[model samples]
Target: MADDFTPRYGEVEQMAPGIRRVLARNAGAFTYYGTGTYIVGNGAVAVIDPGPDDADHVHAIRAALEGERVSHILVTHTHYDHSPAAVPLKAATGAEIVGCAPLVLDDNGPRADAGFDRDYSPDRVLTDGDVVAGSDWTIEAVATPGHTSNHLCFAYREGEALFTGDHVMGWSTTVVSPPDGDMADYMRSLEKLLERDERIYYPTHGAPVDNPRRLVRGMLTHRKQREYQIVALLKEGVKHIPDMVARMYVGLDPRLTGGAGRSVLAHLVDLKERGQVRETDGEWRLCATSARD
Candidate 1:
């Protein structure tokens, strides 16, 4: 699907009945157009993922909420672009910060960027199935810890739409960087979403996913293909992440090789845990059982 949605920073665009999006000015390789800060409902509202800590972005959120009371500042995760502005938003509106706890890192995982908001502490920690109610909106928390260990996707009951965060995006497949992200958990989370009946999804970085199930299935299939490719490469004597990425990602952009390597490492770690592969001195090899099965 073509991404035709162009975000206008510092301006409010009503996406649906009560949901408004204010795009931040910060845009980059990871963040598609920009960080989408969603305001759910009027009068008494809930601001989700208050973008970065840019003063202009914070002022824009406050301006968007003019004449309205912010009851909750919801965070999907603590990624720098996703949750840093919660502090300023909370201070400006006196809204309670609600979402997952701080990120938990795995020391043995691959070297990846840990750009998290270290100082962020949610006023209320929401577990799976917890609900945050507003006057016109009621958001049910769905714990999806794959993109990050503390990530949460909120389901807006009124619209039957899910705020998917980075777990599932419309424009691109989510990057699962291990240490903070787990491939097994990420796949399990995708399976978890299949059991729900949400028709639409509002992701943090791109256009709304109209066909939630189709997008999720595509994502799962893509991951499975990558895993299979990795296994095939291991069978061919490719024993390291850099070699696997080189063989798997043909004509990949030079700038993205680092991220691709990290993703390959995440898959390797998951495969090791599943007993399909084994690692010796950081070199990976397919197991005999994997070859037979």
Candidate 2:
């Protein structure tokens, strides 16, 4: 709502050894403003998640470089706030834009205010274990499909830090809105991060998480809690996706209600896939055929 909420919401900060973060400014409904982007290595710098297509923001990145060339533009995901600007930035700097292909939007279509659309696409698609070479730093891609199927995190191969696109963040739990978002896949991605001994997390939108291990644990626990709450609500006869969403997300902001429903649907779909719930003629209830352990 405010004119150019970026300057007020974003901040540029240093992470570790060879990393710098550009934090987004505002905490808009869908945008994780003040999130950090890393500048890895030296002479040949690589900018991660260029944020939005704001002229000033791009200028700021260029200014920070102070004439240093940006060899590669790496994106964590296809969300507009994170990747849309890659096209312009690539045209300007001639940096090879890299990211995974956009995720397939679910049947319900995208949330009204969602930043990205199904039409969004990346220049070069990356998969798990792929590496992007830079002058000073080499980044290894880690496919973390949960927030969206296209989510990718990059770990600096030199043990410097991990660039967590939206897979994880310091300010909040990354939303798993369906049809693109998957709760099960998101948890697996979190578990994958837990298996690593990385030191820091350079998120796309917020501050660098100093204690990534602890944050990962907290995120996992939080999602588990949500799942428990949903399961409990189901026991109370809250049938159908919309009904469950109404009761489970009673006090959430109106704007986020749809996103919350998408998350709830993802959880329900996961439960159903595991034979925990059943949808018959548009109604959702505990699957009568499943055995209770």
Candidate 3:
């Protein structure tokens, strides 16, 4: 994602042969430069991620897609910034809201459904190997549930471009907040992508990822390093999550402190589940077997 990007907020930019991208005006800490709504195909198109429920964004999509039939409104996940506009876009174009299932949780919490788009109601929930088509393009669903349980990456069969929505990103490593986000499942999902042959990855957040497998390998290594750092911190009597976060993230933005805590908690939870660490009261410590290992 080192590529240069000039944010022409509502203009449609042609990315590749049959792919175009529109930038929503919702930039922030989490969203590097806001959500990138991708429009695939020419005549009858499939719009992936209609973006935030901004009226302007929806109108931009409708305007850009004027005279073109919207075959499908595909959402990768139900994040607030990614799925809300599907409602209005579908109403405007009468497109089928196809993709991930709606936000379903056994229960909810601040950390559980943080940044979720609960209003996301899918017309059809696509599973792995499910395909949706336009006139000249086809999208195959790649079920990658990590950033969120319902997260799906759509693969364009016309070209080997994978629309990786938050599962794998360019600007930064994905945050695996727990109760919904799982580090174990996230790691498994990353390894699963290694088996694929998608040449370029167009993440919803930032710039497109070229040579994506290389980035995936590095992401795996980075996560493993985080694991080691957490274990080392535990060995040094850092029993609290906040202390671990301070030691692990030296210059993290204060605004992202809560997310950092959630991330550390995710690692601890994964470790505890695997018997590598044990939680006592509100503290965490390495298991004897893991210490030996």
Candidate 4:
């Protein structure tokens, strides 16, 4: 897989006059541009979503530093590809890592992909309103947890440019992977961004978006359309995530089908929570409506 995998390398681009975005090139299951790293202010740079554990990628980042002080490494989430490299990068640059608190363990157990290394733990946990300052620039933390519970998006308050991790992208819709990824939370997070007036969004993967609110609305509409399609499928006798995925994502990539199932399951969970559907004994069905039997 590694050999076949075309590493989507990253290049540095300016998001604002002082903010530089490093777009990664790894564009597959393992790494979507790896992670979009940002350098803010001169000599006081901040790296967002440190990306995968690729030595070359890390080296590229170190190269990009080019004598500028790397002051902070901010993680949008703790997925292996995005956060694991933060530790080594921190070691190399002596930058303080920042992110959300760990997940809450239930009686069932810690959620899938929850616990992260304390070594990679952020020097400071970023809350909804915390600010990371560069030379003269400031990146405000926005708690946009959807792709993962710990997900955070950093916004440059000056130009209203947002560093959107997996929450939003220019090339593709993000995978709402479960255990940590929730459709309801994701929808809310989308709405959160929609309500904002950000002009540009630099995502962890792919190119930057110019009109983020429009893109957010488009994503929201797509989700709603998918939800309705799933509901209709259930009404017509499709009874589980696998079935809905098979029917809805016909002729799609087999590998991506699993991720599709995760999104479908998230929709099902949201529908059930909304009293629009119900699941029992591994089967799913629509709730009784006034117009339907």
Candidate 5:
């Protein structure tokens, strides 16, 4: 199950029949082994998530092309580590950028990663069921907004494999920051994937998910458990996100607590919308009827 867990920067490894993965150099807490830039098909190929704007990474992608024509540069979302390289790749290959629109965050919600590629406007905006066909590959876009409002998962029709983006990754659960990310939408999106018959998922980060259903179900269960814990803590008079994070995520790395707090806020927002919880002056509490019900 461990495939390229310790990924080397700029290494192009063949994954499936027509899919090859190029690990980007940018590795961190968020991006497990950097970003996995997938190249699908041969002769005429489609690149998925071109990754960061690193010159060496872009050169690696160009070299991986091996003179093969790049018909499409498909992006999952506009996270800094995921989409910025598309610009340079497109400039080099004359490939049209295809995928979700750039994310727009509201000022009222939890703070989001300001480093996202704000200028990432796809040549063609893909809806839930839109299809992008190449000479050898046909990808169907599945709009899966949660990690970001415009997040997309592309299904490689010929291989029955899903390029899941950050919608579902095997390494860790997706971070659902608010305004840009919606927990309700995230849960619904998870349910949406359950209807698909794809056997495998190639997420932007981490190794491939062979048991997609099980992994996705586990993700849902984990989210539900966190939500339950938050609700229970609310009943105990835990009023703010920081307090909730401190109590719920005990022994968590101090640096990650900020991200965890945002996740808790996302859950609270969802609960508040569902009438299960209420927030006043940034203080959260369990609803009386909801607690009884």
Candidate 6:
């Protein structure tokens, strides 16, 4: 959970035993420096999360694997910043586009990022427990549907690493926008990771997460605390989302207000679905069953 990552843009740097990461040039609030596209294995490699459609990043990925065969272009999700490069990379290497199924939900107020990729047609869509292996390494699909309904985290057998897409991040909590981004499913997915035993997590956005279970536990607690805060506010007669946002987040960045509202909405949806809260004519209030929670 360190923010001291140096993006030597378009250069591949060794992370774990069989994992090498290349940073894309696209940087912003969401993408820490840029997308961290990973290459697994030595001779016949599998590229994980080929980032945005930057020609330079694509060329750098191809350059790094010079004289090597790209057996698979494994994608974690179909966000614009994550899966767009798979097209050119597959054309460049003839590798099959495998992993998360194509999805474009009603992304109305879900996220503030570059939006979902509607044209993300994969060659082979993987379900949970599905495996794709090369001679040197193996990748397993983990169906974690929070950030997007089709999001997946690929586990590497040789390196003991999980390629977390946007389900979890080292720098920030994932935005659970509505429709496709369900808070209940997201929380369930986080709990699912605690059942695994991976050494490290290589998220597509930020730095690698060491002691992933600890971070995951803290994330769960933080979300539960958010639920408490929202319920407390509802009980105190603070009805509007913007007012709740102003109260919960002090000195928050002005740019992230919209995303913060979306997150708050996600939490509210989760609470309402759990029968702890109810919304009437755009006004939310504590439900009769709130005391049980």
What TM-score does prediction 2 earn?
Answer: 0.86
lDDT tens digits, residues 67-122, model 4?
A: 78888888887765567778889989899988666553231212233334334567
Over 63-112, each residue of candidate 1 has an lDDT whose tens digit, in order, gives: 98889999999999988788889988888889999998876444342323
Query: 219-265 in candidate 2: lDDT tens per residue?
Result: 88988888787777777777777777778778877777777777887
- How far residue 28's Cα lies from its native spot in candidate 4, in Å, is 1.3
TM-score: which is higher, 2 or 6?
6
| Candidate 1 C-alpha error for residue 269, in Å | 0.9
TM-score of each: 0.95, 0.86, 0.95, 0.87, 0.94, 0.95
Candidates ranked by TM-score:
6, 3, 1, 5, 4, 2
Q: Which pairs of residues clash in candidate 5, taking residues 3 or more apart in a chain or in different chains?
A: none
- Which residue pairs clash within candidate 3? none
Model 4 lDDT, residue 144, Cα: 87
Candidate 2, which ten residues in sequence have the lowest lDDT sum?
1-10
Q: Which ten residues in a row are the worst by lDDT in model 1?
A: 105-114
Clashes of each: 0, 12, 0, 3, 0, 0
lDDT of 6 by residue, 20-91 (tens): 988998887677788999999989999999988889999999999999999999998888889999999999
Q: Which regions of candidate 1 deviate over 4 angstroms? A: 1-5, 104-114
33, model 3: CA deviation in Å?
0.5
* Candidate 4 or 1, higher TM-score: 1
Better of 3 and 5 by TM-score: 3
What lDDT does each candidate get?
0.87, 0.74, 0.88, 0.76, 0.87, 0.88
Relative to the unseen true structure, what is the C-alpha lDDT of residue 147 in candidate 1, on a scale of 0 to 100? 80
Candidate 3 — what's its lDDT?
0.88
Kindly report which residue stretches of model 6 are placed more than 4 angstroms away from their true locations once superposed: 1-4, 110-114, 291-293
